[model samples]
Target: MSKIESIFKSCLEPKEVYKGGKNIPASNKKLYKLSSNENPLGASPKAVAAIKKAAENIDLYPDQTDIRLREALVQDFDGQLAADQFICGNSGSELIDMLLRAFINENDEVIYSNPCFLPYSVFSRWYGAKLIDIPLTNPNYHLDTEGILNAITDKTKIIFLTSPNNPTGTYIPRSVLDDFLSRIPKNVIVVFDEVYRHFADAEDYITALPYVKAGHNIIAINSFSKTYGLAGQRIGYCYTTSTIANYIRQIHKPFLLPITSIEAAIGALNDKGFVEETVKTVKEGRAYLSSEFDKLGITYWPTQGNFFIVDPPLPEIEFANKLMEQGIMVRPVSQFGAPGKVRITVGNQEANHALIQALEKIKPD
Candidate 1:
């Protein structure tokens, strides 16, 4: 008899594409961590202060309901969403798992694209849901909405969409999203993971909130990890219809969000200046990196998020290894199902300069 669950053999662990400079030695040259798509400026100063104060009350359990943070989101959305319609989790990743646990039935199907977030397939299989993967549109790497619409079956329970898609840094346009939604059966839940939304400045990009308000089975998951630079604190939330939110909240365990994490998220939400500055830095850094890539004759996708997928002259792993030897951390996209491309996160000026220098030095002859 098998000792563990029979399903364990079919489930694959998520690939660690980025390790946040863990590979660098202590005595090595100062590491310029540009692997994970994090805010180069670090967490908001106000968030740091709030976390320091909240640390004093470590003995107290967090309010699992996440009332304050939900209210903050509602206010941020200009009251279009209610507190009851928002649910907070340790991270957007946790929320993904919760949605699958609360809604996906055995053998039900979940559809997403290749080169998308790793957690979607991981959690879907963990819950015994069948996964259907669609390829991104060629050259642009946008979600193939027509392919997705064609893939849906009566057994399909969830459709996972990632805007500013990880590794590719591309997004589905508003027209595509609208048309796709119009065709999908209302019974299927659509989850738009927009953790990188704040950094997106694409002209045709639109959020899924309108569909949510119109009573569509849509949920938008966002995180403090990207925009607010609170990745280490692990706070993220989702916006959806109240009924769905209630279901997710019920599935959520009590006190999943720690006191310090919530406090830091709340402070980050309220800090407008810090957010604006972070956005500015990312926008500028993205442009600078793109230009540098051009000067070095490297091809890269035009990104709407804080990272780019560059095609270096050498294999991605080979290029990434060269950079790592120079104390630079970057992510290779082989495990993300996009071989020959390396994902480069935009960093502050010094880090960017270091990366550019490394790339130029290692340019294939």
Candidate 2:
């Protein structure tokens, strides 16, 4: 065996790299991608302008502190959260890794919903931490609060909760969250990811940011990607207690997000009008897709997120391939442990129509 291979034989097991919805490479066909849950409206106009303006200064490094982004976030929170409580990262995924690095010790336990966020398991195992995955409750595919509570042990260090959880598109209600938080063990910290918050329209859906302000042992991470249409910019921030924020700051890479990204985020924040329009478009698209699924007799969970998990009328892979053949792209969720299921991101009016048309053609009668 080679020296490097021998040295790392027992380390870093092989795992499938995450592949969100992507465009097919052929230059000829017109493609409508509803695979990745990217904002179909694209980036905010103001943000695009800001990036153009900042392009001239690409040679210089960004402000490592990210004071402007943090300050904007604080104002956006309406004074409920202070700037000191924020920790910016390349994306919410990076923040997850930082948490694993800063907190998880050998054999330490981490808990999260099964088939929720894939990276939670990946990062936990990378840190040599024990991962306890609790399956979502049936019928709604919501968080299994009791199962999570029961699974907790002395070694448990973190519990990851993704609001309007990915793939499943279900969210934990406020009452459930309150109960879960009250009973959570003192040794554990809950990491709440609210990347899709803006798309959630359910009345009972509550953000965990308030808990952070109340000084709970929770960190709420949000991104400009979904709501602000800045996914390509790779900007996300978290709200936590000052103590945890300090630790995250220590571990967060220096100048992690570039100046251009920060400027774009700042501009996105300024364009509240654009944010509202994007949310409205997504809400309408979600309704349209859900109604179409119902008419087609596809079994799908009600979603507060901008995506839907549907049991396609055919085998998952075959169904996804059919969609791709029609020049439409979507996610097959078998890798997320849900065989025979696929997740579709709500796109713009035209893309939504294209997706529905594609499904109608392929779905078994």
Candidate 3:
């Protein structure tokens, strides 16, 4: 047998995987990239300075335990959680994978929303878990809590909840989440991916931290990649009760988070002004994009995240290609099970204006 066939016969083809964005080649001219929902403001000055200062220590391995960063996060969360409650990872995606491996057994069922983050399904399948996908509600793209609850079975081991869900930008309301949690069996672990929590504007939307604090089987995941503009730094963390947190840490490889990333995150945490400024920019950009969509007669869901999903009149793939020709990049949601929808990252004022201008030229009257 060929080497590939002998090593892993059950593996699927690479083409079957849904990659996030098209890679744009570097050119002499700068490109305004809005394909990924990254912080347009870039890293905080404090974080940048910290990273530079930490460069001299590159010869040494990162603090194997990442205690200082964990302490900083504890302080940042305002003592809502203890230091032992957190586990740092290379990125939010890595933390997601760790949580899956740590909690899920082979062939166990994993439940999540359709048109949610694509990785949840991919990672669950990687661990040989049966995937249960629930479709979002019509028009609003909100989670179907009742449907999700009904899909649960004794075999179910995990439920992935993404507030301000990817591509859809819809959040689970507090009442809906509470009801869902109450209905779920205690044996199953619920992961609340709050990577975009900083952008949420609604008062009634809840973070899963409270559930974790109450000693529920819930883990709250957050990333510096979005709000803190530390996407390139590759640092994210999870917060849960000490019991589950310790279990996750046991499986996590030591020193996964680099010393530089840890220091940068610490500095970023201290720069509250920068975080507030990023929120303001994203909020303003979201509002502007929404108003423009209204004027263009395009359907879109109001979002509390750094991005919004738009139902362009054309097929999403074709729309995205057309936008690309105009030097604009947007996320096509076909892979996430919403083929007609396009998820546009809210950019700075200039990038937003460019996107609107390009849309005006191609959008059907």
Candidate 4:
């Protein structure tokens, strides 16, 4: 066996995958899938058209530079940022891996919130960094910023902060973020994963871009997957100072993004109407879900993202299994460090209705 294989021996294992509403097996009737937080309204017509047009160009390699897509992003953001500030990847996961490789050195410390996105810790471990986790406060599931700052030492190289955090929809308030940044050592690189930024409602919510502009050692990672309904296309980008962006590009594999994905992303960026429609639909569905949960007497977090976390009356794994038996597939939070809680994605009105109906049946009266 190779050294790499030996290193990964214990980590290599297949896990069960669940899709919220994909448990119906294969009946002719369509299943309402609320499992993954995919946009149920589907991709924008403009993006579809762009993909179709780009299909003719499959014979050629994509522009390694991805200039047109970067330009569109620059224009969409009103020229506040330049193309040089962006680095496109196959998905947000790939971007995460790239950042880990670019910044982390052997045994360097990487700090992130527990019950957060598992990939941040996974990548940190893969790159030989010490993964430091700060658990959230109970009940509210808010980040422990002071604990995070106190955990930092000279070996700390990267800190991952996710707003509207995964598994739990709670977000770090802007004031909290400002205070945390002020206390952390300047040498540590911070990654603000704002993949769910569009769903936030707090008036004080702000992207870390301003901090980057102010010359802080930070990177803002965003994805078209959640809001743009392009998760299948696997497109995401990171914005940072030109210096860090150049470093990431140097370490990134050339031509990793295909032509079709680039065109699709560009098309999605231009489809402001579709983006607005998605946001509206999600907001409405989220409100509807909240109301339904309230009426059902089930407890859930107040979400600012496409998904919400609920502490069901039953054990989370058992509750999820029961829902799956009824052809509903919600994600259990055990791996995300919150046992007895399940994370559910908000879908279209019909899908949300289906989920509510399923819960009503399985939940205690």
C-alpha displacement of 33 in model 3, angstroms?
1.3
lDDT of 2 by residue, 218-258 (tens): 99878888888888888888889998898778776777789
Clashing pairs in 4: 20-35, 20-329
User: Which candidate comes out best when scored by TM-score?
Assistant: 2
Better of 2 and 3 by lDDT: 3
Candidate 1 error regions (>4 Å): 1-25
State candidate 2's TM-score: 0.96
Off by over 4 Å in 2: 9-11
lDDT of 1 by residue, 1-365 (tens): 36675546444444333323244458637888888888899999999999999999999887766888889988889899899999999898888888898888778999989787777887788877888999787877878888999999999999999887898999888998888899999899999998998888988988878889998899999999988999899889999999988877777787778999989999998899999999999999998988888888989999988999888788777888899888788888766768778888899999999999888888977
Relative to the true structure, how large is the alpha-carbon lDDT of every model? 0.86, 0.86, 0.87, 0.84
**Which TM-score value belongs to model 1?**
0.95
Q: Give the lDDT ranking, best first.
A: 3, 1, 2, 4
What is every candidate's alpha-carbon RMSD to the true fold? 2.2, 1.4, 1.6, 2.7
User: How far out, in Å, is residue 109 in model 3?
Assistant: 0.5
Q: lDDT (0-100) at residue 238 of candidate 1?
A: 90
Could you tell me every candidate's TM-score relative to the true structure?
0.95, 0.96, 0.96, 0.93
Misplaced by over 4 Å in model 3 are 1-4, 7-15
Clashing pairs in 1: none
Q: Candidate 3 residues 203-300, lDDT tens each?
A: 88889888888888999889999999999899999899999898888887777778899899999999999999999999999889899989989888
Q: How many Å off is the CA of 255 in candidate 3?
A: 1.8
